[model samples]
Target: MALLPSTRAITSSAQALDLIPIVNSITSLLQALNPRNPNPKNLSSSPLNRFSPFLDPNLVTIVITKQTNPFHALFFFNWASNPNPNPKNYTHSLRCYEAITNLLLHHSLFYPAINLLKKSQKLSDFFIGKIIKAYGDEGNIKAAIFWFNQAKAIEKDKYLYSFNSILGVLVKANTIDLLRTLFDNVVKEGGFQPDVSSYTILIRGLCKKGMIESAQKVFDEMPCKPNSFTFNTLINGFCKKGDMESARGKVDEAKTVMSEMWLNGVKANAATHLNILKGLCIAGRSAEAIEYFRWMASCNMDLDAKSYIVVVNEYCKLRKIDEAVSLLNGMCGRGISLNVISFNSLFRTLVELNELHRAILLLLQMPQIGCSPNYVSYCTVVCSLCRTEGRMREAGYLVDDMLRNGIGLDATMYGCLLEGYSEAGNEEMAMQVFKEMIGKSYVIGLESFSVFVKMLCSKGMIVKAENFFEDICRTFPAVERDGYRKILDEHQQITQGSIKEHQGEESS
Candidate 1:
């Protein structure tokens, strides 16, 4: 049914409408209606009494629809219908109920919507389905089950949608045990039969929790046929598990399903191909995975950023830098924007392969390719180069470049430079970096702090080390004190033992 014009108008209004007074009016009415309030005087002074002249049920419903918070509507509904309600003026029409209920659901006010349903004088499949969905959305498996059981008393047709909603909630919650029981109940019940969607939900939950065999069992036992989403869920589940054997098995299974889909005139789309590609990558079959990726390009399948990233990461893992770069160029030519993640993958691989120069080249080229390098991109190369012989100076230059580009030098970057300087025995530069880092927002990581302290001690600058340790204790009082305690204990033990030896010598 189409919405009322007034109802539609209020919801689309862009202004931030205030409903606090309306809510206050209704809540006050509720309190006055309560018999327990002994001092129930001045009913005429209540806001409801004052607004009664303008409180048309239809008009108030429009206001309810406009309210951002559903509680306001619930309070308004209660006030309208609860106290000495006039049949002609105060009755909540079906349209009014639907409006408020939908508004409640839109705001994710599940409990209020459910309460509305329970108190509703009229119940329908729509309201029941909404209640079940609301509970599911709340991630309240127990509440969803309670409502499902409550729905059993509802008519069979009404219960059907609510039942499916509950099952879907179970699937989302990964309540496998409850899912099994609910699936059994649907079967054991005389009239209701589980639909493809119902089975898909159960299968997806199983697959997600790594129950591949059980998911397959449910797939095989399906009385109805499965759709692409059903197949995709299982395929993606296997890939995410990262178990090579199972991933391979699932890949073959997915291929079989795709073949069946083709025979049935259901064409495999990009998502279908992407799932298989992900599985192949997880199985470490990079060669086969690239073949599929190429096939996608040949078929003109639209490849998204994720698809590019998956292929890029797989190629990087196999140390196929040239192939990965080709994919990046191909994406650019095809008008696909490369995200930071794909670039980072290439950066990581280059650094790992000890191709620091190549990694730096790519990092510099990132902005030209429309992908700005993030902190990780710069830090990965800088830290890697800092570990190499005679490359500390270059790493320091990269940090300056990062700052010139308006990318702030974070704690990790500072830590990297400090370690590099200390390792290179450039004590002056190390102390400079340490001083600049002391009061910054980025708290240095514990390991880096330890390295800085040890570097000072190893340089025979004991007084400087002591002062630095005192600064640390003052600056990061919350830092784990064990490192400080160990250092202090060692120094104390040396002093005490020397004093005892000196006393013994004096006695001799």
Candidate 2:
């Protein structure tokens, strides 16, 4: 018998199996397995069970005949590929692995499915390249580099494709040193010419890292002159670095080059406009940021989440709380969803303005907008509440709420609550919170202990304050010890001045 059957015979056999009908029938059968079936007994007696033999191991040959739907074919291929003691079936495992990888790559489920195969210790440089590409999609260059190294170590033969994938990842990650080392290796050992894509990735990464000078040098040295993307990346880099003069010059250069080349119809994209706006914001030119925002609106360019965030932060930084709030509300009115960074910025501004009520309301509104309060949001609100007069109870409630929602309370949050109780003249409650912090093995910082000691001394608990001060002095660094000593000196000065004032009054 031939090692492989002819295509005609395989096609005739597949048609005889009527794969489409079989898939439909299987799908229906799986659907009927639900728990809400009205007549359970009828399902129990259905004819689907008679076809249960179709799922049997001995029926592998028959299952292969019915391979059609990619998912269903994968299911059968997996069944055929199971490790069997029989030596004759070893080739089936290779076919099954190839089939599964192809199906997953086609559907873009490359990373997860490749991970599943890796557990079986069966992957080659080809499979590793696919995995690296998937990691690149997720912007996870570290994981891509790790897998690339693994592939190189195991593959006996040096594959240039593997080097290219890793180099691209490193460039995307802005790992300039790694990129240079790999580039040298590629040239020395892999003997592959660097492509335009490779050079572009490095230039873009350098630009993103604010190494504009190096990026420009790379651009100048490119054997194949630069393209528009290369220019755009450089311009965006300069804008990000707040070198607007250079950014604008690059833009003008691009236009000049395009005109000279007679390459019309190519212009800046949304990112180009957004970068300019961001640069203006970072340079504290809020008026310019707003002007560019309006320009973007007039040009009908879709404003992104970051565009709104930049304007909101700029307004907040200038202490224009009302304007920031108005912008946030306007963004919602325009259906521009706020992400975590935007919400955190707004929350911090509210905290700084001592608008605890509004900050609390914002925290409550996060989940409604499909945003959850992260650690930063929780910490901001907690710190604000701690600073509020007569709001120790509310601060306590928020801490408990954070814990209940599985947001692990950190040492700083615990310290804030302790300080809140102490400031509110509830020393006992403060002690309780301190005990909780100690139980969690959190190293209490010097500033925190200093606050506690001052609170204790104010309440005429000098001995306890001295003991706590001693503990802090022992644990803290030299710089922190000096800070604690300053607090202690201030406390002593206040005490002595009070005694002198009392004596003078008595003598009078």
lDDT per residue for candidate 1 within 424-503, as digits (tens), equals 87889988888788877356666666666666665656678677667777788888777775764465455557668889
The residue-by-residue lDDT of candidate 2 on 1-508, one tens digit each, is 1122233443323235434444455544444443232123443324343333233332343443344334444443443344333334433444456556655655566554676577667677777776777677678787788888787687745544666677667776668787877776766664446666667777777776767778878877877655557656665665665455665545444334335333534476666667667666655667877877877878878787788888888887887878877777777777888677877888888888888888888887877766778889889988888878888787777777788879998888888877788788788987787767766766676667767766777776777766666655555444466777677777767766777898999999
Error of 2 at 171 (Å): 2.5
After aligning candidate 1 to the native by TM-score, how far in Å is the CA of 428 from where it should be?
A: 4.1
Please report the TM-score between candidate 1 and the true structure: 0.75
Report lDDT per candidate.
0.73, 0.66
lDDT of 2: 0.66
Off by over 4 Å in 2: 1-163, 169-194, 208-232, 242-269, 353-361, 364-370, 388-408, 462-508
Displacement of residue 498 (Cα, Å) in model 1 is 20
Best by TM-score: 1
